[model samples]
Target chain A: MAETIEMDDRTIAIGKNHKLFDVERIRADFPILHQRIHGKPLAYLDNAATSQKPKVVIDAISHYYQAQNANIHRGVYYLSEVATQAYEQARECVRSFLNAASTEEIIFTRGATEGINLVAHSYGRRFIQQGDEVIITTMDHHSNIVPWQILCEEKGAQLRVVPIDDHGELMMDEYASLLSAKTKLVAFGHISNSLGTINPIEKIIQMAHQVGAVVVVDGAQAAPHTPIDVQALDVDFYAFSGHKVFGPTGIGALYGKEKWLDAMPPYQGGGDMIKSVTLEKTIYNDLPYKFEAGTPHISGGIAMAKALDYVGQIGYPQIEAYENDLLNCATEALQKVDGLRIVGTAQHKASVVSFVLESVHPHDVGTILDREGIAIRTGHHCTQPVMDRFHIPATSRASFAFYNTKEEIDRLVEALHKVVRMFQ
Target chain B: MDTDLRDLYQEIILDHNKNPKNFHKLDPASHSAEGYNPLCGDKINVYLQVEDGKIVDIGFEGSGCAISKASASVMTTIVKNKTVEEVKALFEKFKGLVTGKVEPDMLELGKLAVFAGVRDYPSRAKCATLSWHTVMAALNSKEEQAIVSTE
Candidate 1:
């Protein structure tokens, strides 16, 4: 049964005290957070850009390199078998993480950027036709926007964008109206990186399905914060990066339904993605192997599994509850600053808080905050179009994670007040 | 309560940031160019008024960090009433000072030499140099379009 939530300040305040995990213990697991920056304790609030790895994840990568370093899937040797087993186990772990229907549906790529490019080049080239419409949202990251723009340009198709309101929420009504007979595909982000607005992807998928359009979800931001069930959402394609989830970089997963995977052409051609090859013609391998052409990042894949296991052991439900509390604390504390305006204040948001001061540039704020040992992301954040939509050059963002605390937010607020006083 | 990098954030940089110089649009400028640092999203537009090979007036206006804005403020002060050749020589001296290729003589660079400490931060070197690069670009190039970013 769905849990009914009370929508009042007191109930929300009560919810802050009920986290399932121990925040102090969780913070201890991350070694980087304990360091001193510029003589002050490092208050890392750049979780949206990338998360610091825990000891478990660090040891897992080191252990693999030291003990089991071999190419996967191609050797009769003992070490090769061990490596292959670990790689496939990682795939299964990711399958469970996303609640995917099968391991065959998951194809590992470099990251979400590469995953989107693969779909745009392979699936879009094969299925989408000229004069067709591909709908995306204003809140999309550059990775989601540029690849589709390239595909649409190549196929002579038109790209349509669904606008968002001042609150940084997608206009679902506008999105629904854009769906028509000519709409071939609909791609959007599950959670916006810049705004932290969680899109109603299930409803979006159902609406696109009514118009016979395929839906692709950019889950780079959502995967770190929420429980993702690809099957329940019924999204045709979903992509996320490992680095953002406390895993090693250069590894990510793309989940496409078996039917769609079977229908799409191979993304790249090489030894692994083929069943047999002659000079004249090449027969592509089945499902995922067809997409994963080259020898993959073996160490990265195994390390990602360890990262997923780390998150699993902590319990995502617990992590989410704790992070929401941090978000509330940060929002309230930051609001108290004079001349400060929170940029994205959607009703439903993740752990990110993007804001701007009345007269201060974000770069200036970032530089001053750095002296206080407060690490936050500042600038356009690779979402220039979103910046354009907001009519600001950039914003200073402080994104939270489960390991963060209210005390750290207190430090941030204190530092921000000093910065404002110094500037104004 | 204190950080080692506090020396980099000296009072002069903050004062210059609060009261920036040459911070107005110069219409009918003989030369105007914009520069951007994509990494930090710091932008600057340098405008020059040249008459008879001497810079009569120099103005700049844009948004960026304290370092970039302060550097621009100091740049406008030094480049005024100077010839093109003198400005080019000053650019080289300033570049060398900020990159740590040479120890800055504060007597020569005036308030601009305060930014010599920024060379320690490799990532922020571009932020410090953004406006100077725009000045150089506007002085050298014939193009009327704004240069987006130095980075």
Candidate 2:
């Protein structure tokens, strides 16, 4: 069936299940993929850093600003009502995407970083006591690690870490042993950004619950690859970024269980987050609004819904299957190069592949590849502890999306041979 | 390969990076400073022995890309036996060479002119200059300070 979305002034038609997964068709949807860089066709392998926006997502943003620009929630004018409906509808889209129990459980945030920071401030202040422990993993991004460290430092609590093995997979046995009555919280990433390892977060969540500890999942990387069901995992809190999921930057969502949110103090104070305010006392608003304050990124939120719709149309099953093929091809091709060592060979992985050559530094490789118009991330990937654990200075990571292809992976392998030749 | 890439990674740079000159710790160093770029994961220490207001000896040891290692290696050879004022002047010229601020032929850049290609890649200019900044910090400080970070 064909569906038409009417946005006040513009009507768009989307045909459902009319075609199978075609990389060419998908690539055509993103305007940025068509341009040439340095006289070579661009092979963008830096999807983990930030994904390029599709034309529809970009158009949605322009449409919002053009026809639906107004202050939401407080205005009674026609434009205001339209803008407010769009903003609130975006929240529902997020709620359905994550399979959260209620719309009240989803709170708009700046990104995954702010989501973690919100829980760290509000819940940590309410429940975490002196001498309590907050457990994190060695493979967590700095966003997940730093907020907990800050919270522990302020609360006089100790921060515990679950170490990873050489494969970049968390030692689940170690994580189980680290849990005890003193453990107040556990925060970890659903997928490792640098290594591409998909963590066993379901088991991790269940273990944390047994100890009366709350779990906050950093799902920034996982959202783009796999499906998330907050209700199925029974995860206490889940956070993801919009840009990582092909949406606009500066917009994300945090899904928290209603019980924990009702007990936690308000994360921020402003106009929308309060029901009534006086010089002496202020009563905060209900569930999600209590966490979201002030005028939000209205256009960004609306466009993010369109982005989610785009992904939903493709369906995660087909996307995952296509990306897995790409990841496999890239892994095999990269391994063929002499003296090339692929980092993070976990049992389960997303589409990211990180590698290092024997003599060439990753920065040098990045520069060489850029001349060929192939963009890849070269550095610690914001997981410094992962670098330390592996005893590596840095790695060159090529993360893929559904829009990527076998031809691009071949190009990467060809360029890598050139890198090896230059170094030799 | 493009000329810019070849120019950036010249034969001289490859040689220096492979077997860097004065790539060692200066035993009993009178002044020393460490330079690190957290983003690039480059960490290096510049060691100096000064006498009579002159840098009598210079050496460095660390891990980095080809440009940074070569820059540190060549910097040791040029600044050795020069007066502190001369080395500071050389630092200014080298910074200008990499940052595209000063024309290469306008000043006596010597072998440092090889880094002129770095101006095209803005991100890499830092790798070419981190060691220079660290050496300058070591020379200017009376007492050893914390590691200089090239953010």
Best by TM-score: 2
lDDT of 1 at A75: 89
Candidate 1: regions farther than 4 A off: A1-19, B1-6, B146-148
- After TM-score superposition, what is the CA distance of residue A3 in candidate 2 from its true location, in Å? 28
Docking quality (DockQ) of candidate 2: 0.80
Output the lDDT of residue A189, model 2.
Answer: 98
Where's the lowest-lDDT run of ten residues in candidate 1 chain A?
A6-15
- lDDT per residue (tens digit) for residues A1-424 in model 1: 1135433322222244343355677788999999998778999999999998998888888888899988877889999999889999999999999999999999999999999998899899999999999999988999999999999999999999999999999898898889999999999999989888888888999999999999999999988898999999889999999999999899999999999999998999897899999999999988778999888998899898898888888777777777788888899999999999998889999999999998788876887788888999998988888888998889999999878888889999999998777766
- Count clashes in each candidate, considering only residues at least 3 apart in sequence or on different chains: 2, 0
The DockQ values of the predictions, listed in order, are 0.57, 0.80
Model 2: share of real contacts kept: 0.70
lDDT of 2 by residue, B41-125 (tens): 9999999999999999988999999999999999888899999999998888888889998776644888888888888888999
Q: Stretches of candidate 2 above 4 Å error?
A: A1-19
The per-model lDDT (C-alpha) reads 0.87, 0.92
lDDT of 1 at A220: 93
